[model samples]
Target: MNQPNTPTRVRAVLADDERLMREQLRSRLTEVWPDLDIVAEAKNGLEAVELVREHRPDLVFLDIRMPGLTGVDAARQIAQLPEDDSWLVPEIVFITAYDQYAVEAFEQGVADYVLKPAERERLLVTVQRIKKRLAQRQDGASVPDVAEPAGAPLQQLLHKLSGQLNPGAKPNYLQWIQATVGQAIQMIPVEDVLFFISDEKYTRVQTARIEALIRKPIKELVDELDPSLFWQIHRSTLVNARAIDGITRDFRGRQMVGVKSLSEKLEVSRSYTHLFKGM
Candidate 1:
């Protein structure tokens, strides 16, 4: 008879500003995911990022808001770690108190999240999902590198949350883009931009009247553009929502967006299909 295989141990780190919250989460995780090893704990977002860099654990549970650095900011840094470090980016499960970030979280396709106080049932679901994802990755699945601009959705979510929290503070979104057209610099109103597509070196700006190129990439543009006006349909593409006429499916069932004024069709990646689910 063949011997049974032993289950692989999963390593994890828990980061929260409050000591009590960290203890409570650890206790709950122990009850739910017994195989999960708590390798380290952090008291702040900055500490959390450092811990991740040192341990490169399989998972990280981060408080959405922490002292010094926010969890979203920490995750951003962790996702952009240098490849030379040879660290596998850990799966992130944000622990949040606010319900407003839920939609944004789902839009980012995050691994999982646990509500504050850490309920056993919810943690179980998260644990199960993490296990499935880990197995898939171990089986040679083609997972995208975490340290890529594909995380722009999370950045946009963070920006929205910050604006909501500040209340009185209004973000200065880019109203116009200055692009060099031959020898003259032309100021193009952001509202007039139909879409932006980035290649290796530059981003192509398109409008009904003109097409121009800029040095700014889609990642940088995502921060400056108004989230309400633009939707990131792909890693290298951001389309003005007002310009989107409709979404259609190709012969292979891929989602494609038709622009109202432009004749070009935009291909939507599977990762961003959630943006057009209703359509």
Candidate 2:
């Protein structure tokens, strides 16, 4: 007879600048999830990112406002991390002490939000929702490198919170990109660009007339550019929605995107295939 599979224990990382807040949150979590293993704790957002990268925990509870990198910034970095068999992205829960103005920005269902000095009733509800999501992921783990959908809602929520944190400051999306050509710097209007492909060091900007390179990475550009105008087709590539000519399938059944006035084709990463669903 075959042996039954063992249940995987959920692990988590807790990040809060205040020791007392971290302790209180940990205590409450223990009450709700007795079997949960909190593998690590961090005192700041930078530490939180490092811990998460090292532990690859099943969940993370991050205090929204931390010194240096804010929780939102850290979450952006975490979301951009490369996923593999050993490290599937963990579910994130934002812990905030802000008033209703800030709390209202969190989108329902993308992830849970907990107020400071968490009440048992509210925390339990969040716990139950997370449990259901974990159960679903467990069932789906049989697929090799399962492609999780882009967390667009979460990204938008984060963007809103960023403004809330800054109070008077508003986010301005990118309008122009400065790329260095052979001998001079050229300012390219965002709409005129065909697509952006990036490597570790530089991003190549392609336009109908000329191609140039910039030092910005795709991860940073995703936050600055208007999501509706430029869609992220792959981890390393972002294509202009207006410049897309058509999408075709390759022999391996991967979706390839073609740009207007450009022969180069961009492959849509599995995580971003939903962008082409309607087409």
Question: Candidate 2 clashing pairs?
Answer: none
Cα lDDT tens digits, model 1, 150-215, are 333444666766665566988899999998677777999999999999888989999988888899
lDDT of 1 at 129: 65
Please name the candidate that would achieve the greatest lDDT relative to the true structure: 2
The TM-score of candidate 2 is: 0.74
Candidate 2: tens digits of C-alpha lDDT, residues 1-279: 532232368899999999999999999988987878999999999999999999988889988899999987787777676766455567778888876523443332345678999778888977765765566455442122122332443455566667677879866899999999989999999999999999889999999999999999988998998766787777788888889999888897778999999888998765455455545
Q: Which candidate number would show the highest TM-score if scored against the true structure?
A: 2
Displacement of the residue 113 alpha carbon in candidate 2, Å:
0.9
Instruction: State the local distance difference test value for candidate 2.
Output: 0.77
Error of 2 at 64 (Å): 1.1
